[model samples]
Target chain A: MSEKHLQTGDALPPFGGKLRLFAMRFCPYAERSVLVLNAKNIPYDLVFINLDQKPEWIFNFSPRGAVPALEYEQGKGIFDSNVINVYLDEKYPEVPLQAADPLRRAQDKLIVENFSAAQSAYYTAAFNAQALQPSHLENYHKGLELLQKELETRGTKFLHGDQAGLVDYTLWPFLERFEALPLLGKSEYAIDKSKYDILLTYMESMKQVPAVKTYYLSADMHAKFTESRVKGDPNYNMLDSSAEVCCFRPRKKKE
Target chain B: MSEKHLQTGDALPPFGGKLRLFAMRFCPYAERSVLVLNAKNIPYDLVFINLDQKPEWIFNFSPRGAVPALEYEQGKGIFDSNVINVYLDEKYPEVPLQAADPLRRAQDKLIVENFSAAQSAYYTAAFNAQALQPSHLENYHKGLELLQKELETRGTKFLHGDQAGLVDYTLWPFLERFEALPLLGKSEYAIDKSKYDILLTYMESMKQVPAVKTYYLSADMHAKFTESRVKGDPNYNMLDSSAEVCCFRPRKKKE
Candidate 1:
């Protein structure tokens, strides 16, 4: 878990009092941690977590059985995606989540709120067969459209504004699937590559951040997990699913 | 909003002030803030949140339409139950969520994760109309039985150990519902007031916490919310089927 010894797959000595990331690439939740550490230029070792056959350490570590946990110096474990994100921000105030203005800081929380609990409906639609249903697609598109609208007007180059702040970095990875819903079937608001130009630009800029680039999309992940739903079709689980397939499984997003 | 005027019913004056917890009786999340605040002993205003109509100011502060938000006068305002809970604990590290031992704290997060997130199915089963269904009820009881069984060998009084900390306080009110649940529907293994003497004693001990007794389960709350949920033919909000006629709703136990 030491920053000095990065994810080079060496002897894998004990994390000598360094930050460690507990994650699986396919999981949107775990991906956020990678983005944060990458964004802040915080060096940490990445411990790959296998969800189907979990690592023994993760069981007691991740109570809810999810990936993307953070271990700070041996055992300062913080679960619940948002909690760890803010903890990293607060603990390392150099990259802060809030602004000098209290109201603006509170506003940052609203952005995270949409991504976390409020987005439940969107994910529900995305996950279920309902994404194929015409009316349901409308709702899914509507939710993304609403987010885009919010970001365009009030949001910044990043989610908080100007700089890529905590909420922005945290949510960008999860939003990669916005276009996939329509692929499952079809939708009124098409978001393949055309409709969401700003969103696309935003995503690209977010990815370009050194830390984000280092951890995600290009991490040279050890093993890619493919659930039964995402069996051997190259069309499925590819990196470009956001611009292609609509009905992608969790594993699909990882690719 | 001002810790000085928690009961004053005014938004915390814009000048960054302090954290005031406007809470309702039996709200577990509010208990989270209060416990952390007391443990940290951070000076805060503990006011009674009026849940009946939901005071207008609260809506302005939290648009998601929920309570357990810390309209921070000193720090930035934070809403959402879980986010605020971790924020307070991290910000004021007097009584850190992670116990002195690193692994201990990590395990605490596990307790929160499993109980907080995993138990949602049980909550839905117990409260939702599905709870009325035989299958859902069966799953619901099964989840509870699993939790109760886990509690059997954990530690001393609380979920972690002798110390009644965050994880224990967070779930106290909702677990009390377990006590009330068996009473409501004569379930085979839902929460027998007699069967689990340990949990019952903890419930009693938890209610005795000054913050718990004074702020959370105060005298008028029974008249305000619970009386309606558990009481004598109270007016039910048929509009929200989720709003049962029963005399409960222990501060949503955070859906």
Candidate 2:
């Protein structure tokens, strides 16, 4: 994968027969789909796009040109993280990511809906510090407390029993980013060990999930990206490299 | 069925084993769930709430106090129109509202997503007239054009084929309200018969569906409701009366 984002004037990459995911390297929403694909062990190609200078073809895949559009076929595609994730789960049902019970599925969606406040608070605190408020911090902690309560009630290694499910992957990207808030000088947004012992434990377990382990970034690394984004020039290509060793193939022997 | 807007002092209705849908009578989002419940022949109780002065118990059904919330169980509830609607469809698969094919299901969701701009434009035009803009109108028609083109390609009587599926029910609420725009004096949002002939035919066909037919409101009726809402005091109780006959039952003889 090239870390250089395809921008305006760039041609669409030639279609690969395997599934194609149009993503922004730093977008949490894109990361959700990537983590799901990886968890499901679906082989796919990833194409990063410059959000500020989106290529003309991005709209063809995603009407709004949003990241995480999946080109399931040669030309046709689906967008939205949840929508795409659900589609991929249903289409490739070899390893199901959703709950078997319909009601449980609805409850899972509710959990995601309920946690949105913290996600918003994190965004405001990290990217627009001036807009951050005491109420935002309150809401952030309220969301955390709710997650802790839920974790206690479920009493599982992960939210979806012994194994992480769609609900876990859906919320993991945002949780991964939340850790960066404290490093970004927003101590109020930190997940206090004493207060959120259970949620913190769940986070630790999630980090060990093989799928997340491969794509996980450190809080310090996320802080760096956040700072660059706050400066109006996102360091989207900070991870620039086309030669990273991938699981699909062994690294070529050093010549 | 009472048009009386239940306030904070209102008592929670007795629980019925059948599904209970808490909704705002005139909200398009709520209407989405109503149409779905009716379409599926699901025996559910409908309790309309005054959105401004909501019943205290609504929070038990929806944490944010937003409708339509479904009390799938006696005390437990699920919120969000899409969430509730999808739950109902999946929980009661006797009459499937979704396409059997996963890709088609993804496409159906895309159709609704692509139409959201138009839904937004209609909202502004109907309620916040001052904020209406040329771009809003452009996006509104763009959505309509996209739907029309989709209709041409799919060549189905309904977006879901012979039967009205989730996509139809999802988009119909907005289309039903779009007609009210012209009646409310926002002529720009009208679906002109000349340009939208096929789309108009589709609308007429949708009106004839037993589910939509039972809940269908005329453009004039919708206009009156929109006017009342725009005037600051939404006549939420305008439809008051549990006596009104529903598709599920015949009116009881008066003593």
Candidate 3:
């Protein structure tokens, strides 16, 4: 019975080593990490993990069993996307992801937390409407409404002050997914360009933020995400993500 | 709107320059930051946040609203215990909280993620029961069983390597809470000390670690937590630590 271990007693990986991003594009959690990578000019080998039938190593490696995990050559892999975002900003300070000041960092943290946490209702409501399991709709909608009101208030170019700082990069890419989803047939929940002009404007601005603009999701990866996979394969988690598993539940077989 | 911004143009706060830890002793999320503090030996002023009536400043300053938030000075604050843990470890590298080797770090991330996450389910089972609500009791218990099984297979002293590294520090304290619980009526749910001798022994050994022995939770803070108001407070994201909230839903007064 051999146990696997990462020997710290050995040689170190090079500085400009392979950085792996394991995620599904539509996933806001994964997107947060992507936004930072785009915000930073970090080159990475993108491994689209099949999240449904997750590989043993992924589950073995990621204790929480979530996506947007990163494998950095120099240190341990980052599990939480929020955690990864901060790490990306700190490790690669060249581009600067977080605001220089600490108070603003707190504000940015608030926004990121809201983005990751608050909008669950909207996702729950719409997620599997086709499947009809009744996920977290009421709570999800309430969260979105609260967010919409906050979006109304900010009315800025980003979540933090007028500029995109750690929080904006931490949260915006995830919002774009919200932007695309139909919010319970409500003609949208938050960024409506009318009231939250700044929210939409900021998103447009985010697209132009050099590194963010260059952030890419290949067609093949996108295709892989939506495609169903053979059951019991370790790579299933990667493919499982393509089903948009987080925002909703699954449809009956052959849906 | 006299909005306080930190990064772009706002000035950093002057207070807490010596390092201030806003944490609760029993909280696993808060412990992540504490572990970094202990490992780094960064002297700090512990501001025990009232989890129930969480001081308005926590929500006002921190959007998600929680403790384990770090204030370096009056002007700066870092939120998200998980992120703060990584930040503290990196900024104060006297005793690093992360693995120096990349692969090991990735593996450590997995162990931490799994353990922390399972702890969440475990807490959910207990707290949900306390609230007299239906819970994922089976699933939560299953997670515990899985954790116990994993520990049986993993090494003796610490996770991944010999000494107590990041993974060890992040989880040891959390498990301590479960071990110390009253078990109420669920005897089977109670951790059978004999079943996992390695874990029990390791936990005992961990108590001897300088960082572990030096750990202290203020008595006043404990009163706030074991009480109600644990729900949705900024102090507990219910995400960072394997956390769950319990409360005797609002009661009607005999007015």
Two-way lDDT contest, 2 vs 3, winner: 2
- DockQ head-to-head 1 vs 3, winner: 1
- Candidate 1 lDDT tens digits, B92-143: 6676654655445555555555555325544453445334445555554554
* Per-model DockQ: 0.17, 0.72, 0.13
For model 3, give the RMSD to the true fold.
11.1
Q: Which ten residues in a row have the lowest lDDT in candidate 2 chain B?
A: B246-255
lDDT of 1 at B236: 26
Return the candidate ranking by DockQ, descending: 2, 1, 3
Which stretches of model 1 miss by more than 4 angstroms? A1-22, A40-65, A69-80, A83-107, A116-156, A160-162, A181-201, A215-255, B1-27, B30-58, B69-78, B85-107, B117-165, B187-201, B215-255
- Tell me the lDDT of model 3 at B31: 75
Identify the leading candidate in terms of lDDT.
2
lDDT of 2 by residue, A228-251 (tens): 778776666677755354323543
Residue B54 local lDDT, model 3? 54
Residue-level lDDT of model 3, residues A1-255, one tens digit each, is 011111223232233567877665456677778767866768875554435544455543355557877877444466787567766766777877666654455555555565554466444433433433334444444445555566568676556556566676665555555553443343434455665554565567777766566554443443343233222222234324334443235433421
- Clash counts per candidate, in order, are 14, 2, 36
- Minimum summed lDDT over a 10-residue window in model 2 chain A is located at A246-255
Interface C-alpha root-mean-square deviation, candidates in order? 5.4, 0.6, 5.0
Candidate-wise lDDT, in order: 0.56, 0.88, 0.56
Error (Å) of candidate 1 at residue A119 is: 4.1
